[model samples]
Target: MSDPATSPERHPDAHLIQQAEVPPLDVDGVQAASVGTGVFAVATVIMAVGYDTLAAAGDGWWLGVGISGFGLGLISLVYTNDRRRRRRRGEKLSA
Candidate 1:
């Protein structure tokens, strides 16, 4: 006379997992940005050598270019990490 099927509102495992609770935000970006800086350092050295030979520029000038590139790359990395942090924190990015 009645429907034979029934659905459980919530599973036991799911309830337990929810009760445990987790940290709010993840710090993956902080770690990755640090590594990226190291990579950019090496890349700058390589670019310096290349420019020195290709343009016949002096060591000082090439060194300056390499240092500048390295700084730019690092700044970019930091900005990227800030964006990631905002995303993980559930904050909406501004349009």
Candidate 2:
């Protein structure tokens, strides 16, 4: 029987498998927010210009969908930013 740590064949490149500690970035969050804002702006325009056409469903269904999508995107953007901030501060990212 041979010791695993002393055998080169058992643990080759052990130093290369180490994990690095780094903070998360906000590029993705910013991009998501930009896209969300664009969607919201376009939806607002549609609602203003074609309210009558879109209100065919007794109400403005498309408007609601657009607004919801925009809201979700914004939420995602904010959540991502918060995660990045927490990561920078060495906080645990569980949620």
Candidate 3:
């Protein structure tokens, strides 16, 4: 009454299929963004005090750029963590 082709034991490789573990989005993005923010902060301080100090008087344009970079990194980190939280709750992303 049993067909060999339809039997699971007939195919030993059937149970061997394994799924790879996926990395969490928040962990990946947050780490990178935090590092970026720290780097930008350090660079901003160095630029504000080190280079062309007499001319810019700590108001250099590069300081603004570095601050912007830090802000953007923090925003991205927050977004990434929020996405991870939503995913854990099994909520779908809205358009």
Candidate 4:
């Protein structure tokens, strides 16, 4: 006798799971990083422009937040670009 839990015939959604085959999309990490960095750069500029108003409202930390985000995004952009270049050149990535 087969266990009910182990039997695919008794399991709900078993057929659906077996038929699920999603194709992977080809994506560029460098492009994604560039977009993220651009967004952070814009946010930093907006924060800088609103610093005085935000400070008066006790929200001056927004500027620091923006700066940190932009800095991190820049780092990501550089890292992604380097990785993409290395990949194009067939270099093995360091684990």
Candidate 5:
């Protein structure tokens, strides 16, 4: 077998880009966290704005909305931290 370093990167039998054709995005974790956080933030806003209307139906909506806001805030913090971590990781990798 030929050594990988001497071979062209593409796999000969690949119907599409093979697994070896690409490397993982090192910042994918941060990107995913940011996306999740954004979704949660939107949910928080929806709950906060409509909580009273929802609560009028006697469905414990206030508590649920409050929890949603708190959870979103917490996740936002985590997302921010992950971004910083990703930047640092990138720096390390590049260096």
Candidate 6:
């Protein structure tokens, strides 16, 4: 006899699951990166303004953190924009 757990009768929805086809989602990475970069830029500005207060409060590193995040977000924005452009032109994206 077949194992009960492995038996076809064990799952009534197996056929439905096998026949289901999920469509791929179309996302705009450039837009997402732009939003992220904007947020980071705002944070960097806030941190810069509060640098003196933060240093006095022993949170001086927050300014650097904000700057780094803003920098990385900018990089991501550039990369995503390039990727979107390449995709639109039907170019093969580098892995």
lDDT to native, each model: 0.67, 0.74, 0.75, 0.80, 0.65, 0.82
Candidate 5, 1-95: lDDT as tens digits? 98764579857665553457677774436565566667666766777677787778875566565576568667766866766777767754333
Tell me, what's the RMSD of every candidate?
9.9, 7.6, 8.7, 4.8, 8.7, 4.6
> In angstroms, how far off is 91's CA in candidate 1?
0.6
lDDT of 1: 0.67
* Per-residue lDDT over 1-94 for candidate 1, one digit per residue giving the tens place of the 0 to 100 score: 4432333554444533345567845444655666667776886778766875746645556566667767976886878788887988899888
How would you encode candidate 2's per-residue C-alpha lDDT over 1-95 as one tens digit per residue? 88767876866657536678988764437666767778786977778688897687577777777778778777777877777688788897674
Ranking by TM-score: 4, 6, 3, 2, 5, 1
Q: Per-prediction TM-score, please?
A: 0.43, 0.53, 0.55, 0.72, 0.44, 0.72
Off by over 4 Å in 1: 1-40, 46-59
- How many backbone overlaps does candidate 2 show? 0
- Comparing 1 with 4 on lDDT, the higher-scoring candidate is 4
Evaluation by TM-score, superior candidate among 1 and 3: 3
| Candidate 4 residue-wise lDDT, 9-40, digit = tens | 67564543455588755243777777877888
Model 1: how far is 67 from its true place, Å? 0.4
Instruction: Please tell me which predicted candidate would have the highest lDDT against the true structure.
Output: 6
Better of 3 and 6 by lDDT: 6
Runs in model 5 deviating more than 4 A are 1-20, 26-28, 58-95
User: Predictions ranked by lDDT, top down?
Assistant: 6, 4, 3, 2, 1, 5
Instruction: Provide the clashing-pair count of each candidate structure.
Output: 0, 0, 0, 0, 0, 0
Ten consecutive residues with minimal summed lDDT in candidate 1? 1-10
